[model samples]
Target: MKSPGLTLVSYGGKRYRFDAGALCTELLTTGGPGEFARYESLHEPADLLRWVERSRLPSGLEMPVSEGELAETRALRNALFQVVADRAHGRPLAARELAAVNLAAAGAPLAARIEADGSRGWAPGATVARLLATVAREAVELLTGPYADRFRECGSGNCGLLFVDTSRPGRRRWCAMEHCGNVHKVRAHRARRAEGDD
Candidate 1:
């Protein structure tokens, strides 16, 4: 069953569940740089709104998104991709990518409010600026926080998804055990059998 923060992705007609483990990493799925651009889903403003709804952030936020924000969002996402890939591979942080993330995070994030029913809600005046800021801020935190060393690219050699390992042992290796992990296990088993080692 689908849970909050988990998004289903279709790869060449095969559907798989993906949990990016952090709000920022989740945005990487919408689109990315170079070859990843083929997966672009933010060609229109409505697309960004849809992404917000699907994001790990709680629902009930209404905001207006402009064409410029849409463009900015794509740029932020692209920068984030490089930042994450670099970090995951133990490389030095790229100054340009770090600057883009910091620039967006400088904007005001979405404010929080307590509802009459004792539930959490967003404060008034939500906007795409706040949404992007929230995402960028989270990226900043994830990159510098306790789990900074825990963030990793998917273990599948060909999978480009990134995730932070929040589990107690921090042994997470795949984007989702039900997806990449299983595939790896099956492939390994077949290889063993083919070699008469099974």
Candidate 2:
């Protein structure tokens, strides 16, 4: 029951596909330098609940989320983005950002459970804090884990999404080949044609 807006672009390997879930918090930030015109998907409490319901989380975690909880979730997302971005740039993660994620995760009632298909997944408590805490914990694990070294910002001029480069050679440059990769190829082809005409 994935959310309609939850677009999962495969970039990393199977174990790290959750990176796309983390980056889905923000959208369309590749317009310009420091462009903050990004479209936020979690605009309301209903949006948050929808995400929780549709996410690949354990069942029985759906609950009525409040506006205040939505605000807190946004804050958590920002902290995660900062940590991941810093790691991508080879900068040290700030202690305060890590603290913010840990504080939220401390209140989460998440547990590992086996799904009907025998796969393991996280099941959060029937509370807003727990749901958000699950996501925060994921960010913590990703930023601190060895895969963090594979972080790469998208090379598209208008797509600044982040992804883990799990390629064998570790040279992945776009968030998705069908999207940014094609864009780059087309642009380059056009430029070459223009040069030939000149």
Candidate 3:
């Protein structure tokens, strides 16, 4: 189910929410080296957001999920799970640069250059590749650098949550107050009562 602490981006007049799944995919944590190496394996950014919005698990107080929705949600859950595990275990980063190069070469002189030069030396393909690589690298660097703190995981004990820390203080912890925050508060009150009796 939709966990707390996901990030949202506004692009093309639409708001795209990014959860652990998108982050892991963006970071190329899905599949083995070869799979991630092929950028085609990556889902479209919009699809990723749709997937996140559609998947949500019930917290303790909520009713149990229906069978159909449960299965669909679980599949989405598994996607993020595998990605997180890969990242935690230090899986190799995908060859995104190569993918970027291939994408940038579409409809350009790069295809002809490859045929002419036998894939060697400076050519249209190489130029496109270089430019694509530069842009991708810079984008990633900027995201994970100055805005590094904005990338965060949720702190709720019961949620498999992750979120971007976009709060003014960059101290955001919960994804939603209606869920995790209330759960935590109740837990704390119970804990305090127990402490008082002892």
Candidate 4:
């Protein structure tokens, strides 16, 4: 009954709690054990572990999964995760990624409108590369916009977890009320009781 975060949608509807820090590990498709391990070692193990705990991957696909393949795939996912992270942080896109997009936008914007009152015509897909570039642009927008707003970091005591705010008021607190939220409340109550006893 629980909802998943944006990163977990990578498996194409096969939901699972995917650790964001280990994104590269989940996405790299063609690599050996040493390579995968080195990639995973880039981040702090504890942080990645915490992210893994909060991540959720969907189920239902009949995947021919293997340990080796999973590692490679995770690495590939990592690459995508980095891109989203960079975009969120307002960093420039990598050189290779931007070259073609820049070239196309140079001549004419990818998605544009004519003023009709005498303006230049819009030619978005002037080339194949530009069309595919448009698709990638839209994908990133969808993720950081709707998806980012939907799932936010918990307001609890820095638990390093994120949850989907599916409440009617769109103000759900903590990753789960039965877990982190309840624990925090109980701790606060105990502290108050100790003060009263004193």
Q: Pick the candidate with the highest TM-score.
A: 1
The local distance difference test score of each candidate is 0.87, 0.62, 0.39, 0.40
Q: Give candidate 3 misplaced runs (Cα > 4 Å).
A: 1-142
Candidate 3, pairs of clashing residues: 1-56, 1-57, 2-56, 5-162, 5-163, 5-175
Report how far residue 127 has shifted in candidate 3, in Å: 23
For residues 5-123, write the lDDT of model 4, one tens digit per residue: 42332214533332222222232221223333443432433332333334332221122334443333344334444444345445665654344333333442144455566543434
The TM-score between candidate 3 and the true structure equals 0.37
Q: Which stretches of candidate 1 lie over 4 Å from their true place?
A: none
- Residue 28 Cα positional deviation in candidate 4, in Å, after optimal superposition: 16
Cα lDDT of model 3 by residue, 123-145, tens digit: 33323233223323433443356
Residue 176, model 4: Cα distance from true site in angstroms: 1.2
Rank candidates by lDDT, best first: 1, 2, 4, 3
Clashes of 4: 29
Give candidate 2's error at residue 177 in angstroms.
1.2
Candidate 4 overall lDDT versus native: 0.40
When 2 and 4 are scored with lDDT, the better candidate is 2
Write model 2 residue lDDT over 1-198, tens digit each, in one string: 342223444344222122343422322121111343254667788876666655556345557778887777777767666666777778989888789878976775556777898866656446777766666766667666766687778887665676566577878887767667876999999999999999
| Model 4 CA RMSD to the hidden true structure, in angstroms | 13.2
**Of models 2 and 4, which has the larger TM-score?**
2
Q: Which of 3 and 4 is ahead in lDDT?
A: 4
Cand. 4 TM to true fold: 0.39
Candidate 3 Cα RMSD after full superposition onto the native fold (Å): 15.6
